[model samples]
Target chain A: MIDRTMTPLLEVRNLQTHFFTDQGIIRAVNGISYDLHEGETLGIVGESGCGKSISAFSILRLIPNPPGKIVNGEVIFEGTDLLQLSDREMCAVRGNKIAMIFQEPMTSLNPVLTIGHQVMEPMVLHQKIGKKQAIQESIQLLSKVQLSEPEARMNSFPHQLSGGMRQRVMIAMGMSCKPKLIIADEPTTALDVTIQAQLLELMKGLTRDIGTALILITHNLGIVARYADRVLVMYAGRIVEKATAKKLYSSPSHPYTIGLLASVPRLDQDLKKSLSPIEGQPPDLLNLPKGCAFHPRCRYRIPKCFTQSPELEQISDNHEKACWVDVH
Target chain B: MKSFIINRIAYALLILFFVTILVFSLARLLPGDPIQAAAMFNADLSNQEIVSELRARYGLDKPIYIQYVIWLKDFIQGDWGTSLGSGEDVLEMFFRRLPITLELFAGSVFWSLIIGLPLGVISAVKRNSWLDAILTTTSIFGVSIPVFWEGIILIYLFAVIFPILPPSGYVPFAESPIDNILSVILPTFVMGTHGAGLFARYVRSSLLEVLGQDYIRTARAKGLREKSILLVHAAKPAMIPVVTIIGLAWGYVVSGSFLVEYMFAIPGLGRMGVDAVFARDFPVIQATLVMVTVNILLVNLAVDLLYGYLDPRVRVRGNLGQ
Candidate 1:
């Protein structure tokens, strides 16, 4: 549905994803929802196994079957529900319209093919172009990603490239179609800090130039601060907080968000003091705690908070947070 | 790459040394006296004189080390001595059978790749479907049947029922390549089917695993069609293991698949080794065994190097034996 002034390019409403493992049914993404407007970066931040990546997989339907399932959701890109589309139709939408950059680069590339062929494949298949045209486009994409000697690199296999270069190739492929929404799930998590910064900056610049909506999913607060326009902080498969980058950094309401920000080593803080990591482990998705999932790990866990799960209540005109302990 | 070649050559010499000495000693020690072989080998010498000459000529009376050293030096330079049965040079005799063995090896390798790789990929991509079931059943039959038994059955059908396809014989490929191919097809098929069946299953499983990877996911997310994703992204990486198996099987086909040669009446190295053992021609048998070992070893070395070449991560620095 269209907003009054700015229609969101992608709107995921009441998404519920589950994993039926031997242990039990894990509610991976429990009733999470978000909106991405045109040319906006929506960053989903959470610790490992907190459904940040799972939610992105749900958008692409890349979740492996017989284990993971998107039980309920409407991934409305434009007006079409991606879940409802047939396999063929979904494929057309996948690279042509909505692209995703995965976490690992080494395992992501095909070992047997030249880098040129890997990039060219999507162009030829989706675009229905000739081999020459496909190759030309591939070279152009490689050059755009700053790969030197495009023709030579084209003949070289994935094994020939460095990790950073491979991630850049992944980014290049994601940008190949100039999709309306590019879901980059921990794209730079595997890279070194310096390369990570370079890739993030490149991605930001590229997306801005093309007006491509980005769903930047990660656990890094610094990355969120630098790249994201809005932030969704997930904990135990639910969005605990949602706000603009400025507001989320200044005044995070949820206790999990508060603990996470506190845990990060601040450059401004005393170097002599040891970092205080949050006291408890993340609540198991399979067997969650009663009432609020964060209760056992919280310092301000009220008795009533243990009896009821909190819904996302609007805290400000452009910010919302899910917590029983509301900021006055 | 240069280091790889040098390493292979050095190790190959060691392999030749041990294998030749083993075949030579074992052939000499077998129940029938090698004295009789020596006597049979010499037409001019008297029986008593032949026995004395044999001890001196073979250096059998001397320490085993002395015998091994004399043999190893000549063996390195392609001098396998002379055959007791034919009086032909062991090198020449081995070469005569080589054409046949190589032809069979080439045919089997070609057919296995042509059949196995595609079938395996199809089964994996269409896993659990009717086609997969059919391929699974067919490949199971292919693998379960022994090459010898399968060879005989094939002859019975093609040779007897059809009254056509020549059931047995060895013709040089150079003499008539077409005739050689035709004569050898049945034996090659029987042998190739085993590898084809094994490779197909490996390929399918390997492919499915690669297809499941996140890189493959990235390929699909590229909006490339399914064909390109399967061919370019999923197919090649999945094939690393399959290539490995095929490469290893080249060794097996060169050495282990002797029964195929026996059934088909081909004069390959396997057949020559068997014939040499029966005749108690120690030199011929030892020479053939060494040649087979060298061929198989070189094949394995090449494959190892190929693995490194294909994937940048796998570096073949030296030949460390298990």
Candidate 2:
């Protein structure tokens, strides 16, 4: 039998993804590493354009052509290096083993086809099932995602469905093949809070039932609080901190993480005090600073913090932080 | 649905009425008298006799409105009296020529769609490759080269140079469908090339836009093949714009261009329109313009109906309207 620690479901030693634009080579996903447990939900949190989504896309190799490139990275999943896989081989791994749902449901869903066809497409490709059987499974998936009148919905096109229904359909499709990992990239951002809660709850239950791991990528700390087992905080393409959901919320080590948690409206926060925002915009990925990327924006930046870069090192048995600050 | 049809048909009728009025008035406004043009060929009647006979024959002695009513009444009954120039029944002659123009459009559109869609999808999926480059270049050629120029070139090379395909003529579909096809094929392709290029390029761009959408990424992430990602996910919505282009192209092919028929020397209405304009045959010109206008409006209505079927929001809104 394989050693449990050695055979983690996913492991990335030093992944680095860069983008070659006309302006300059932008390191969208700078070197970072994390391991995913088979059954646990790993929430990847970062503000927009911090390479949170790009990191996930690089794992799937779904980044668009020309400008976006995974210059150096090893997205190790299930004991295989995905970056080494050929286009044909990567395609096989993409839909069956790992799946991703994008942010916008309205544009994400194909306009012309019925949701049924889009859902069954993966089944048709990977399972080698006939059209009729694929369609039946599609109906079942629609209902599984909590859509009512699933059978009638089979004939209806994407525009016929509402935003929430479409997002559910997206979830159902991602779950169709029972993939080992599902990347939900801001799955609920386009939606309001109530719908976001419902979708999160649905995803949690479905993932649990199927024994599938989930990579819930979102900016909202509140979401990861209840849903994720482990949380990886990213800022400017680098992992700033990694901890269990409870520890990350109650005891954030990185200043960025602290700012994020503090910024969230809380019952404990002073009523008279205005809400705190991240001090400044993210560092320009093209022209990165001399030392810590977050130095310009970091509230607790020391001389060492500006001149020296910090690596992610273990603080506790499971918790880790990448900041230079030595917090007890 | 009923309301849509009713509204469209009413609008078509209104447009058709204006076309008729414009054709009738404009034909009369042209300098030469139809009777004088007729007498020019007669060689027997004096100018005075020609004027009186034409006046009596057309009931031009009556008020212009009365003449219009009489003419419109006769036209509705499919008796357009006689050609002001040929003295032959206008309806009978139009009917004889009508099938030719319809066959040209029907044949060309069918070929264009069959060729355009695959070319478009392939170009979209295999973007920036040499194959796409060739298709893009060829489609550009198809779009830029005028139908008449292409027709002349094809005839010179294939018919004149190779002498394999028949030169140019019309065979009734009933007489021999094979000959009918041979007769219209060259002209049809020449006419269709631009539409094929236009449709394929537009459709490719549209499909590319949809393929880059989030759900498509989701489908890809789900491991759906690149082929299905395009065929199932991208092709359907991309076709909306394509449908509009096809409908408009069909109208232009039906009404605007007579060069194809003129080059091939086919006896189609487009050619007849040219002849009527030259000879100043008011009734024939009016009828032809109205027919083409009505056809275009009808096809646009069909496009809207197709949109309803493709998208349910339209259908639901349709129901709500009802």
TM-score between candidate 1 and the true structure: 0.86
Please state the error at residue A105 of candidate 2 in Å.
Answer: 2.3
Tell me the spans in candidate 1 whose CA falls farther than 4 Å from its real position: A1-4, A128-162, A267-276, A302-307, B17-23, B37-82, B87-92, B126-144, B152-182, B312-322
After superposition, the stretches of candidate 2 with alpha carbons farther than 4 Å from their true spots are A1-6, A129-140, B129-134, B319-322
RMSD of 2: 2.8
lDDT of 1 by residue, A1-328 (tens): 1232677788899999999999999999999988889888989999999999989989888887758899998989898888898878888888778888889988788766678777876667678899998888888888888887887888877777889999998888888878888999899989999999989999998988888989999999989988899999999899999999998989888888888888898898898898778888988899999898989988888898788999998999678988888653
Model 2: colliding residue pairs: A95-B222, A95-B223, A108-B215
Q: What is the lDDT of residue B21 in candidate 1?
A: 72
How many residue pairs collide in each prediction?
A: 2, 3
Kindly list the per-residue Cα lDDT of model 1 for residues B121-142, writing each as its tens digit. 8898788789999998888887
lDDT of 2 at B236: 67
Show pairs that collide, candidate 1: A95-B223, A108-B215
* lDDT digits (tens) for residues A211-328 of candidate 2: 8889999988889998999999998899999998999987889999988877889777788888888888877888989788888988788999878889998988679999888753
Question: lDDT of candidate 1 vs native?
Answer: 0.82
Best by TM-score: 2
